[model samples]
Target chain A: MEESLDSYVDKGLVKTYLFTAVIWLCIATTVGFLLSVKFWWPAFLSNIPYLAFPRLQMVHVNGVAFAWLFTAFFGVSYYYVPRLTRQKLFWVKGAWLLYFLWNFIVVAAVIEFLLGNNKGLPYAEIPIWINYIVVVAVVIYAINIFGTIFTRQENQLYVSLWYLMAAIVWSALNYIIGNWIPYYWATGNEGAMLNGFYFHNVVGMMVTPLGLAIAYYVLPIGTDRPIYSHKLSLIGFFALAFIYPFTGAHHYIYSPIPVWVQTIAIVTSVLLIIPVWVVITNFFGTMKGKWTKLTESIPVKFVILGSVFYLLTCFQGPMQSLRSMQKIIHFTDWVVGHAHMALYGAFSLFIFAAIYLMWPIISGKEMDKKLGNWHFWLGFVGFSIMAMVLWAAGLIQGILWIAQVPFLNTVWDIQPYWVIRTVAGAMMVLSFFVLLYNMWKTNKEAASMD
Target chain B: MKRSGNVILIAGFGFFLLGFVVVGLIPWLQPKQSTHTIVNLKGKPEPVNEITGAAAKGRLVYIHEGCWVCHSQFVRPVSGEKQYYGPVAQAGTYNYQLPMLMGKRRIGPDLSDEGGKHTNDWQFAHLYDPNSISPGTIMQPYPWLFHGSSAKPTKRAVELVAYLQTLGTDVAEGTGYKSYWQYKAAQVSAVSTVVSNTPQAVREGMKIYNANCQGCHGIKGGGNGPAAASLKPAPWNFTSGKWMSKYGTTDKDIYNRIAQGVPHTSMPEWATTLKPNQIWEVLYYIKTFSQKKTA
Candidate 1:
């Protein structure tokens, strides 16, 4: 037995990209609970044009950022590139034609953003011919993850393949600077300073270097212990690829460009708190005395609650890039609760702790630990009551629109914090239906005990 | 030191092309501020207007009806939103705009000088039913930009109200409403009847203020009144003490300036012959002519 069969790779394209990332995280938590009940029912289903809340908030922000966090980062880099290149998948039918052409280009971009056929940017709303089908499916997944790291059987190259080869070339150059030069060569405020370097380098170089390369490859293999330093994770991966490409023009601090390019985007967004505190202090110094594997692992308590929400989304992204806190929470709802505390509290709780550490090694069984602690306490108490009612209704609509008060009285005093952020987005859509019913009852109890 | 994948793909695509040549291709290959100035339509200044024909197909039907995702053309000088959306935005105010709706979201408001602020039948009754002309408007109601049960419109609501009457009026041309179209062509002709807060509606609001604001506020509200010597920031005097700190001492800000008139002034709109309690009995007989010029 070739030292146990499971040693090879493409576990059927990592169970079809984690079953299309739990069906686009239940269609992005039912289009983010109908865009948080259309922010306190603004004619809720506005005589349906695909249930408009501006195309269901761009289908809940491209179905939770590119069909559920880029199909759970291509099902955790096709189950850790053949278990860190012991060698296997160089091109198994080019990974089933990149999983049916990346879910038929995200179902033709959620039917071209529900037919409003958009391109209004924010995370590059699809339809520039689906950004050339996501630049030919990120160049056929960077030639099948660099052709299985040049025929390796393991030749020393970890630190999660240097953050998955610089997050697949910084997500194909942040989808051509956030959608082909602001959809064809810039314009006004130089296309809002190149769409603030494609809105914070598409979450700082593509989902914070693929969610810190699956939290530095699932925190030293769920605390057996290792990565405390390796030269401080190679200086927190070249200081987060040179300060997240100059910290996305600090989301254009005080707009009309030039202010020395918003003080070099507020000094590289406060030098991104030095690669978010040296990769969260090397994942809490590799959980020192294997801190009782956080009460016996459910992937080490979702890697210490996603490194404490990636250190509170890099300390509220460098104190909301200064300029007096972007003159009071720039465009309020406190940057929509710091973009859902960095895409659902720090990279969807580190892709739900790398899908509860690769779904019991791709459904061999084990889940139901009280349905993974009620899907991690209903996604950590519904993302802390939806990031404290969108940062206290964006500091009471930026101190009542800076005391001038009357913009419909701060939209009727933030309608009971938008009805408690639609009951914390319906308890984070009932924690993704308790994580798709505990990964369909741990894959039908491991295919009826094989 | 574990490197080679062609030196980490040429230093990660050379720090992604040196952060796209230091924040997006050298400020998109510099050079812009060529020439600028606006005013024209005979008020003079001219030099550029540019956005051609039917306001460039009404800015592609305002980017195909997304209305720049809840308006915002820029303004920001912070907090008084540069006295609520007028100047502030320039980088050659998007010289021939090729796609720069500069919108991020204000939810509503900040149309960066929403040109000639209302009228074209109040932007076609606030785009046909914005809570029937702003009664707690949360916007959304382009009654498919009109026609059936007519208010005519629809050539995409007259090219989206001729691209919102050319936003910020071709870069600061006497900040619009060109003298409220010569005071609504001298209000076609005149008025009389009144009632609502009777004492014969404060004696027909003192004969509707000596037949419409004593020619222009003077029979001693003091703004010299005889068409306030052909206006232009001349009027407002209601015996000074700065008329309730310049036109705002609520009562719904003097019944929304006697039903929305002020836009680039000459006053007019006494809501077509007053009457919301005869404009609250002519704002309680103009606060008793500002308490008879403070006694």
Candidate 2:
């Protein structure tokens, strides 16, 4: 079969990370579902302070960004690096050691947040000490991956490796800027400005590069063609690195942050459409004569589905950064919908495709195709319904607010939409459960065979 | 040499540093706005805006409880927020905070100028059980912030409330409307022009009563509304004539109580929610519950 794919790979380590990622995804989505439900049923778990909305919110955001996506990226990176480099993974033992140590830190950070010992900033809510442990873990991971690249038998670095290296560097820097900088340096609105930078970077640096890595690698292979344009890929990668950092303050537009800085953020945000479309164009170009693969391959369908949402969300992001649009939607559920669309709708879908591709290779067993399709439609339809309701509800709320009506009335008016949001959230959660079932069954069969 | 890897690595890192300086570093270098001193509801200046004492402890409790998550602190100039929340907050108003807690969502109302909007008694009751006063409120009952089964303040709750009370007072606003309302009510409070005890007048009073007072004071003036348990000293039930007279409940006294709110009870000030005539009408409706010849 082609060239034996796994002689140098640590399949067991990849399997462990993938399974861990799915469990954390389940936990995080459940937290998000409860958050939506709590809008109407505030007292459902009111007796427990840890289950309070804010505490649970801390659990939700961090669980997705750190616990879920971070681990999934680890799984994919472990699986992809050796294949791309044509080398055995460097410091395989160290990767396993970091796994348990890193997960322990994540769990401890979550518990500490629930215990009311939190940093109280967006995308950086974990307490400061936990931040140090996280950075050290990343350092070890970087060294291991970099070592593999250094000792590679393949002289030509793949497109995925370019992204892999950038993501490692960007994430380490972005993480420090978000969690650590404020403790020593900034205050008041300055801190908030830094937060806007950190907020976008977590997704921009953490998810975007890694997700596109998987997408770029998987798309051409699934389509049985080379990428559409090498020049386009190069343009997209460098433009993204250059533009993403300047765009975060768009989230905090109209705040106490300086107007010029906000403008800079807005301009850079709109400029992002270039790189975003370039990446999409390259992927679509790769998919040029392989339309039939949509029916033949589940991973191709998911990657394509994720690309559409990625385009919509990235476009929506820049439009929102425009101050006029923000005057209506800022602080509303519209932003919430936009955020969920990016992470859940776009990036998670890309990662799901990777997991689908990787599970069989790593485990030597296949997940049920019917269940995979079920997961796809449920996740796609459920998230679309949820995002639309949040966006519409947010628009209505924003209109009511601008009309100068009572604030409580807006909260009341949106209760019905929240019901829809909760139900759609339930569907998405169920989709993940279907995935969990398929992966678990594969694990069982793989174990029995061994 | 892997020239491509070095280009991506060095340039990617270069972009990261570029962003760090422009977005992160430059903003902190801007001269910070001044620290704002709070003026209490009595129109007295508080000890400079360092936020020490109970209020300072309350600030920590605010963050700890994640109150800042739902309750935003700054008010914007657009969208009638100034009309609604009293003032558009400047950056200096939050100068006391190391990193300001200008939260994103306003699931609750903005607390920009929230000081002295309601009394400590109302704040205590609302914090223990928000639905007690605003039947449709989305706020979760923070009973843990209180004592066992009562609205009595634990140190944290008291500090939290203290911090809340100081919210928008930093900018020398509020009490303008309160004093104006008080003066207007005092002018015509002696006579019951709007509270005629007629069939139509009583019906009008019933409407206002149902809208506002009926939640806490009960449908039959029995102080046994659905939310009555969480309040200390409880809401008043006027079914018994004795309790009505205990407060020297003349027409003027009744108007003053409605406008200023009662102490040690769940009754919030109607200065903002009701007009003077509406309060007088609701007063006449409640008087009918008095089992006395003079009701």
Candidate 3:
């Protein structure tokens, strides 16, 4: 069994995943800073084509969403899946090929977008050829994950395993439906509706589920306690499976989509409150009387804070989906704030926690708690400041626009808000450095343990 | 150990299930009804033809491009709007719209009555290269709409024009169609006449001014319109000497300034927004501003 578990932990795969995560984290954070500066001082990079606001925005979003988060996800999954299942990966070669292919697709997509060959949908702006590459990579991922599960020695699946399996399967299915090839490239004129469907589902099915799966696995393990309620976990999982697909329309509340579609979206979004709150309450309740433990364990701190962000983001998401609320917030920086809170605050933090918790076991070493603490504090403080500033900017912009105060007057009013966002974004950049430092230190310690 | 973990897991799953029902399933099953009513204010009942019409097809293009994110088609009933945009939009104006474009943002102005507001040449120029006709416009030029060629009008431009010309006018009242034809005829007449003995300085200034200022100031220096309307601080009526006085009175002052530009206002610097001789022509035109008469 010891030999088997040892075989399950591949140092090379873990290193590859970690290196990608660190590299992409730096790239994404830098681009994020550049995007914020562009907003604050448009003249700074106004002459450059690739650095223009629109192109920079695409780079920033894709870097964070695809490169940073997915890299982290790959790293964590590579480390934990084998340890949790008590078996070696189905195919190490297959997984390594997936890593290379995934990166290749991301790099090509970024270049295509910079060259102005975009499909023009938010989040789906990558060119069609690049999208096909992503589809190929996803298929490879699905096959590898399923093969690993089928070959596992464990008979009774753990809740973590269930979540991991469900996330992969569901994401694979949703991606195909969301990015329906015929609709996206064929009828370019009506592609917006199809793109909107695909774009929101990417958030709902891909980002949300994957993040939650990692959180569920890491939180219980890091706390040295079993989950508070298995019933609640199942509820959250099934509820997400049933409801997330329809909620994509919420993004179109004031849009030109049919009224019935928006109605479906608003109701689903509001109802999402139940699943989101349930998950929050259950996770926190399990941590009941164990607050001190959280403080002691850096991984616990990251996981708990991530869960808190999840609660905050989902609640804000539902509120923003309401037609009346959308009237005040749609197409404004408010949605940008919401995306950051959901994707970065909740998802990325959870992924980070999963990495920290799993790294010691996978690499056969103990991480320096001091470095972990530094990383956690930086990320927590940085994310909090960034989220707040973005939310404030979005809200102010939304209210002023709706008030019809006057076009030129509104632009003048929001100049200070944009400046504040840039300042807040600086904190996030600092946090990324701290994260890299901690991860690098931990890696060295793990090597020493070997 | 296995038994305990299993029990704990089961309990966790159960709580999640309950939460799902309360939050996810319940919301999905519930009926969502909205109280707000959208009014289409262009003064005509939406024709069945408009519902299944070429305008609807153009609207699909609008959606595909995410145009609604920046440009609202609806004009709200507000004091600033009433004063600036002619009339507030009504619910009837949207009766023909299948999916209404009452967009939520004011990145650009409300475009409810953009029809009959400008000449076809002006619209074509703006669409082909927004910076070519209106220098400070933040709106991305729709080069694709002009077939991705060198800023020439295309069939898509014509179709888009047809859609814009339908905005804000009551076609049922017959005035919308009449005004559209009248505007088209005037554009033809204006294009035919070449001003005789026009100084090179004046000609350059006119080109600069038209490319950078025409959207808001009107092609003829009259403060008429652009497709965007929801400007909170309304666009300046350039025809007024009072407005011109806000800049400066002297011809040289106006020339140097127009060649440069006021900071922070939509007025971009001609060094960037226009060429040097173009700036001089724009300045020459501004010198023609008279306090005694409106354009």
Whose lDDT is greatest here? 2
Docking category for candidate 2?
acceptable
Question: Model 2, range A82-193, lDDT digits (tens) per residue?
Answer: 9888888999988998899789987998899789777767667788888899999999999999999988988988888999999999999988888876645666777778
TM-score of chain A of 3: 0.94
| Cα lDDT of model 1 by residue, A235-325, tens digit | 8888888878876878767776777778887888888898789889999989988888888888889878889888988988888888888
- In terms of TM-score, which candidate is strongest? 2
Q: Candidate 2 — which pairs collide? A: none
**Judged by lDDT relative to the true structure, which candidate is superior, 2 or 3?**
2
TM-score of each: 0.35, 0.88, 0.71
- Who is ahead in DockQ, 1 or 3? 1
- C-alpha lDDT of residue A125 in model 1: 68
Off by over 4 Å in 3: A1-6, A181-194, A363-371, A444-450, B1-295
Per-candidate DockQ versus the true complex?
Answer: 0.17, 0.42, 0.08
lDDT of each residue in B2-118, candidate 2, tens digit only: 788889889889998899899888766667433344444455544435678999898888888887777877767676665456555666666557556887877777776666566
Interface RMSD for every prediction, one decimal? 15.7, 2.5, 9.2
Question: What's the TM for chain B in candidate 3?
Answer: 0.48
Candidate 1's displacement at residue B240, Å, is 39
Cα error, candidate 2, residue A249 (Å): 1.7
Better of 2 and 3 by DockQ: 2
A298-374 in candidate 3: lDDT tens per residue? 77888888898899999998888877777666656777778888888899889878777766665567777776776
